[model samples]
Target: MNTRSLLHHFKEMKHYFIVVVLVFGFSFYLGWANSASFSHFLKDQLAGLETVSKTLSNKENPQVWFFIFIFLNNAIKSILIIFAGLLLGVWPLFMLVANGMILGYVLSLQTNENTLSIVMKGILPHGIIEIPVILIACAYGLKLGMLVWKMGVQLLVPPERRTASVEMKRILHLTKPLIVGMVVLLLIAAIIESTLTYWLVHL
Candidate 1:
């Protein structure tokens, strides 16, 4: 897609993006406020993540392994969520809330002077890119979900009134560029997370 078309598509998706951001922010606040009650559940989740990290850290080239793992995990999930939006956009929305909660809970646990430093050094570098791309992917998924709902509703209307096909074509046209942009950006974010972010956190 040309820059103009891409920009237009994004403009069309601005509402969906705003919905995602709001939902994420609310969930993050909830998680932060209720961290004490959510401690056990969140700890289990964090422990599982730590296990995966440890296994990858033991690899011959841990940094490369980390990069590959992070990129694939994010790329595959982003693609899946877009399709899963066929289920009324449930998956992508759920993912956004869940991720936001986890981030909030993790930060809540950082009850130390180093909290700001950790966020700056460990998250900011990659997260600035990673978070926005993920949010955009979720917005696309939500838009697809809305389109699918319109498709269903159009069935009740006269055949001449149906615009679902046209909307679907627009989404299809944007899909190639969207996926390519998401994958490329996620790759770069993963590299930063695995290499520079790792070094800074350790230092």
Candidate 2:
């Protein structure tokens, strides 16, 4: 991709990228600095995760298992929603909101497990890059969705004059590149969530 095309791609995903920043920024300001809440958040997240892990009865290698779960949980669904939303932007909103809630809840634990610095250890290394990528993917998905919406509105209104077939073809072209970008993104996120998070929490 040339400079102009790259800029255009970023422009298309501006909204979602903005949302990612806002969410994490809000989280940091509200929860990360608070001593009590941060402690509670870590303990609660671990406790809840422990229960879930036990229910599955796969208690083989805990560190590895936790990493797998953490990375898989966010990455898989995030990728799915992004891909699906190429045709329907609304789909990823559900994933984003749901994941946001889970993140809020997890970060909000605020228990005594060294939650303040720990969260940083868990997030900053990989999250810094991965999150923006996720946001961009989501934005692209939403943009694609808007194309469909624009056509639908045109159809509902007067004469469907938006030339959707041409737009649809263009959207398909965008999908391949977008998916590649998102995959690279999620891979980084998984690595951080799995390896970095584990070490941070453990040590």
Candidate 3:
């Protein structure tokens, strides 16, 4: 689809997108507020990520491997969450909460003096794109889940009240362009994360 078409679709789904963002924000707050409570679980999650980081860093062509790993991981997860929303949209929302909480917990670990530096150099470079892309994907997933839910509800209603199928088709069609756009943007984000962010953090 064309850029204008994609933008239009996004505009139409702004509410869903906003919902996804708000949930993440709230979840982040929860994580930050209850850092101690979440410490154990979050630490395990971070440890896994750290392991991956170490492995990637040890690779001969670490930068290239990092880019590939980051892109594939984000892209695949985002795509899966979107389709998985068919199960009442629970998975996508759960993922957002999990991710947001982890982020909050991580930031809570940073000292005040270095927090800004870490965010600016270690995250902002690629996160500006990656975060939004993930949110958009989740929004689409939530939308799909809602439609499926509506379809279930409409089973008892009259045929004339059944619009879920049409909306489902519309969303399915839009996914083509959405997936393409997400992949392209994620590629750019991964490159920046693997190269610029990595360099900045180490420097």
Best by lDDT: 3
List the candidate 1 regions with Cα displacement exceeding 4 Å.
Answer: 1-3
Model 2 has a clash total of 10
Residue 193's C-alpha lDDT in candidate 2?
64
Q: What's the TM for model 2?
A: 0.67
In model 1, what are the clashing residue pairs, if there are any?
A: none
Which residue pairs clash in candidate 3? none
lDDT of each: 0.87, 0.63, 0.91
**Candidate 2 lDDT over residue span 1-203, tens digit each:** 33456467667556767875665456555544453655555455457767876754467676567667756766676566656775668776654543454455556665767556755886677777766666665666666677777777677654546676567776667666666666667777777766776677668
TM-score of each: 0.94, 0.67, 0.96
Model 2 regions more than 4 Å off:
1-7, 19-75, 86-88, 111-115, 156-160, 163-165
Q: For residues 14-83, could you state the per-residue lDDT of candidate 1 as single tens digits?
A: 8888999998898788778899987787788789889999999888999999999999999998888877
Candidate number that wins on TM-score, 1 or 2: 1
The most accurate candidate by TM-score is 3
TM-score (C-alpha, index-matched) for candidate 3:
0.96
Model 3 alpha-carbon drift over 4 Å, by segment:
none
